[model samples]
Target: MIILQANQLSKAYGAETILSSIKMEIKHRDRVAVVGRNGAGKSTLLKMIAGELPHDGGELIIPNAVSVGYLPQQAVLSSDKSIWDEMLDEFSDLLAIEQRIRLLETKMGSEETLSNEASYNKIMKEYDTLRADFEARNGYQLEADIRGILSGLQFNGFDYYHTTVSSLSGGQKTRLALGKLLLTKPDLLILDEPTNHLDIDTLTWLEGYLQGYPGALLLVSHDRYFLDKIVNQVYEISRTHSQRFSGNYSYYQEQKALQYERDLKEFEKQQSEKHKLEDFVQRNIARASTTKRAQSRQKQLERRDWMDRPDGLEKSVAFTFPTDQVSGHDVLRVRDVTLQYDDQKEPLFPSSSFHIDRGERTALVGPNGVGKTTLLHMLRGQMPPSTGSFQLGSNITLGFYDQEQAQLRSTKTVLQELWDRYPSFDEKDIRTVLGNFLFSGDDCLKIVNTLSGGEKARLALAILMLKKANVLLLDEPTNHLDIDAKEVLEAALSHFSGTILFVSHDRYFMNQIATKVLELLPSGLTTYLGDYDYYLRKKEEEKERLALDALEQPKTDQEDGAQNESKESFEQQKDAKRKKRQQERRMAEIEELMQQTENEINALETALLQPETYEDHEKAHDVQLALQQANQTLEDLLVEWDECSTDNA
Candidate 1:
């Protein structure tokens, strides 16, 4: 069932239209994502759907029974109540229902009501109905639900429950708001930039939780990895229009590229045909013998339908990191490094040791408040470690991209910020570089303080590019960058010859550019040889191993000795031989099945390539479906074959 629908929806501020005639729909249990570049009216459209903002034009149809809970980008919770009580407020209605049930129980137990059959029966019926409703709402497990959500959101600090709502930090308050929203259990849950302050662990937990969520989900987030894992449908708002894709973010990207190519080809074909018609009309109109034919052609041309060109392409900032010099093979070395804010508190990392080789892109990652930024600062010499030391390689020049962009002077204009630092560069050269970062014309005159977070980030990157340092230290470099900018930066960094040590929460970015991952922990730094995905897989394998080990009982010395002595027994040897023969037979069977499935898949693929199959949509679809099923069967057989071969070995 369609819970919400928008028909020609539009929103405007004065004369500037943010969303123009946008149409979209959200069905029951739909995991929909509205994605766009910064300031592309994604949030505005969400607000319109949530009824927080009024639409300038068009109709928004929402079923009256569907309750929507909207958590804006910056949700503020101001209350004198403690965090626990604030969360309890979400269940006020259920609490009231419970109160009525209690009152009914009291009246039902009274002598007057007991003597009255009508009153007692009515009270019993009311109690039964109320009890069922309460159970359906999970009223009895409210505290358990709240606790689970809070733990999943990583609210385990000392002040998690004790702190008052008004006393919490902005990020803490946002988290609390999210917890409350989840507890409310609305039919439709809408979250804007919900992953803004989430760490990797918390993000993983939230992804699992939302995957099992009972209601429809609509979220706007710049976290591509999060979107790919959560959202099944993508509605991209670009160039004042909306386009829908029937798959996850990664699939959407593939389909979008294919659609663009197809549209471009169609456009070129139409243009070629129109030009030929025009040329024929022009040549024949002047000849008296072909005047009637020319006139007919002119009429046809006037009545011809023209296609509108696809216009979603907008200019994006270009980024490149070029080094002026090369550093030694040993880019960085750390030995027994320990970091702590104060002596009274525990150290963030104790006896951490790591090294960054030349041209190695290392990503520092951990849970929030695990001192990723502190470690980066220590490496930059801005903070001194409590113990041990780190040394930079010979002739290593450093360029840093601060997450807060504090290196930028707020008083200076965009043009002056770059030109003032590099006095040797001419004004035109500086402006040209700024323009490359998307600061052109009058935009160069805007003060740094007034610029948006994205603008400040671009300006910082521009300076970093000009620095041409051999060692780049980036702190949350992908923060505040739109998806497009992040992609561009990823490309630039992937091509850079310099060594890099950066801290980021962007798993997708890390997967693209990171050569190694250094996970900072309270215990110490753990290094992974591969990217973020590899790190996660390794961690999961380690977890599984630990869990399996936990399940096994410890053997006594006598039992161990007896088992060791019985290892070469005749019965054991005979059983092992039989098991090995069985494993070998199973492996052979799996291989045979895999080969057969592969052959079937190949046949179907070949049939799909034939003209008769290709021309008929239904036939082609059937062939493709059969090929997919065959491929899946082959994959299963391969897995089984591997397991059997391992057992035999």
Candidate 2:
């Protein structure tokens, strides 16, 4: 059922129209995403839909009984009650029903009620109905769900009953707010930038939970990976308008590029025809013989409806890393480096040892509070490690992008901010760099302290670009960047000849940027010599392997003669080589199947891009659905491959 719909919806701030003639709809189980560049009115639209803000025009329809839960970008909870009590408030109806069932049970056992046959039967019937309702609403699992959601949000060890929401940090409060919303299970779940503070593990869990969620989801996020996994439809708001696309983020990107090309070509076609008509009218209007024909052509031209030029990416940077002076083969080297505060009983994390070669992008990932940023600070000489040391290669200039935008809080004007960093750059050159980042004449005069997060991020990037560093250590570089900016940044980093070692929570960005992954555990660091997807497969395989080993407990030593019996049996199995041979054959089969599935997927994607396929909406959808199935097949094949590879190794 259609739970929400908007037609020509609009909003304005006095004379400035923030959104115009917007159209949107959400069905009962739709997984929809609203995306656009920063300040494109995405949040404004969400606010209107969530009923926090009223629209200036047009219709916003929501069914009377359909509940809507909105979690804005900066969601927070503040209450005097403990966190657990606040969460329990979400299930008060179920709790009430449970209480009624218990009261009925007590009444049925009393001697007075049982004495009247008809009343007793009525009481028993009521009890049965209430019990069914309680079970159907999952009254028994309410506490379990509260615990699970809180734990998933990283509040596992906290005293949920004693820790009041008023005592938590802003980020912690936001997490708790999300957990409470999950428990409520409203008909429509609207989340804006929900993945902002989630770690990799929590993100994975949320994705699984939402995939099976019974209610509809309306999300706005810059995390493309999260969008790709959760959203089935995309609505992009641009230039005070909205356009709907049918697919995940990746598919939307693919289709958007093709659409841009199609638009450009159509405009060029019209321009060519328009020029020919104008030329004929100008040259022949003076001659009586062809004057009538020319006049007719002019009328036709005047009557033609002109298509507006396709506007896209209004501000874009011409960005590249020019590696004039190359670094040594090894960009960085760390040995047994660890960090611990004086008051801590143990180290912040285990000793870490890793190396980055020139031109490699390494992703540093861990759970929240695992000290990923602290480690980067130590490597950059901003802090000292408690143990061991790290070194940067010769001739390397290190550039850092701090996620907090700490350097941008100064009162300096935008122009002065860049000028302060590169005093060598002439005024015109400084202005040019700032312009590329969308800081214009008056914009350049705006104080840095007043810039929005996106503006600050842009300024920070402009500084990074001009630094000319051969090695980059970025901490959450994409934090406040819009999707457009992140794409441009990804493209720049992907082609950089320099080396990169960065920490990020964006899975899509990690996959796009990292050639290797450094997993930082509390005890130690582990390295994966592949991309994020590869690392995930191996990680799962390691768990499976440990489980298998645990199930096979080694036989204890028996009498002296029989002590080595189990070892002798394993030796006999090795001599047979049957299991080893079977594993090898199975591994080969998995590899072959993987290749075949990938080929099928690629073929489907190619077909999706073909005019004969894409121009026909029905055909394109069929091919896209097939492509999704094929990709799922490939993932399954990878899991099997991991199982075989781990055992064989």
Candidate 3:
């Protein structure tokens, strides 16, 4: 059945129509991935479908009884509620039903012998029905299920009962909202950029959960791996239109290229035929012998229509940095670099020693708070190391892209920002450079605050590329870019002849760009001589080595420090084993529930299939309740299975 259908949907803001004549349909369990550049009206369309915003010139048809839950780009939670209370909202209706049944039972037991025979019979029947409904729903175990979801989403170690919603940060609030939405179990789930602030482990957990989701889902994200894992359908939203591709992300990319090639060939053929027909008509129009034939061909030519070309095609920018001078062989050197923040006892980077060579591209990787950004700051000479010496090669010019984009002035217009950065450039030169980065006529007039995150990042990058630097230091450069823009940057970096050091969590981006990898563990840096993929392989080998070492080595006084060093490794193994046992127990329970629920569902389906079952309304209602309970219970069980598997992995 169609869950949602929108026809000729259009949305306008002020005088501009952001989405015009849009149409799409979502089916019961279709996992649709939405892709588009920033400000292309993707979010506008999602908001319209979710009923959070209204459309100006269209209608959205949602089939009756179909439920939808939408998670916005930012989640808002009430300050007064605790995380536990907020999650409990998802099961409020079921809890209310159980409460009502409990109260009825108490009243029945307290005072009352029914005065009338019919009243007593009605009371007994109602009580029996409610008990069966409650049991079938598995209403008792809802709290346990919710707790598991919270833990999987990275809320572990926090007391859910005591943590109030107001105490959480933006990312934490968004994660909490996601957990609640998952527990709500709507027929359709809509998430926009859900992985924005998630850690790698949290993202992996979510991917597994979504891959096995039974309900329909639609999401907008630039994380390729996440989309490829969860979504089956890809919807490409261009500036003027949208098209559906019939597979995952990789498949869509290949199929889309083939489609464009085919269309280009067809277009060429039609143009050739139109030209030939025009020539024949012009040559023979005046001659009596061929006048009739020419007229017939003219009609055919008039009836011919050309296919419209696809929009949103950006011509590849063909330019590279002009290197006026080469850096020395030793691009950079850091010795005994111990760093610490004010009021923080732990040094972010302790006694780190490393060197960079000319034209080398290195990636700095660690968890969020593990000094990747701090290290970049130190390298750029922005911050002083606590105790150590650092040196730069002669004739080395540094170009930096920090998270703040410090070069941009917030109050300036887009054109003003570029003009101020390049004061020596002529008016024409500034425009030419800005045009390459998609800044045009009125767009350039917009203030910096008006631009989206991706646009701002692009503008910042465009300015950075103009600087002729031999050494580049970029921190989280690809944070807000779309897939297409990311590819553009990747291509540019591949051709760049400068020494590059950047921090990035995007595995694909790192693999394409980095020639070496630097892992910032608690113990300074462990260097690897290859890209991200190679680092992953080496990491697995290291883990195996540690597992073997655990079996071979024994404890000693001198080895106490070494044992302390291996604490992270030991903790991970312990967690892995604990998760494995938890998964086994949960999987067994879920399997039992799944079988029981399936049996109940089949029994009700059989009853519904029979003509006589509909005659008694009470029996029919009872069976319907049973079917609904079975479905909810099965959904809960499937979610549990996903969480267990994620924990184990």
Clashing pairs counted in every model: 0, 0, 0
Give the per-residue lDDT of model 1 (tens digit) for 352-467.
89999998999999988888998888888899999999999998999988998877756889998889889999999999899889999999999998898889999999999999
lDDT of each: 0.87, 0.87, 0.81
Per-residue lDDT over 187-229 for candidate 3, one digit per residue giving the tens place of the 0 to 100 score: 8899998887776667878887886677899899888877776
The superposed Cα distance between candidate 3 and the true structure at residue 83, in angstroms, equals 2.6
Winner by lDDT: 2
What's model 3's TM-score?
A: 0.78
lDDT score, candidate 2, position 292: 99
Q: Kindly report which residue stretches of model 3 are placed more than 4 angstroms away from their true locations once superposed.
A: 97-141, 309-319, 349-351, 387-389, 521-524, 544-649
lDDT of 1 at 22: 94
Best by TM-score: 1
For each candidate in turn, the TM-score is 0.84, 0.83, 0.78
TM-score preference between candidates 1 and 2, better one: 1
lDDT of 3 at 95: 90
Give me candidate 2's TM-score against the actual structure: 0.83
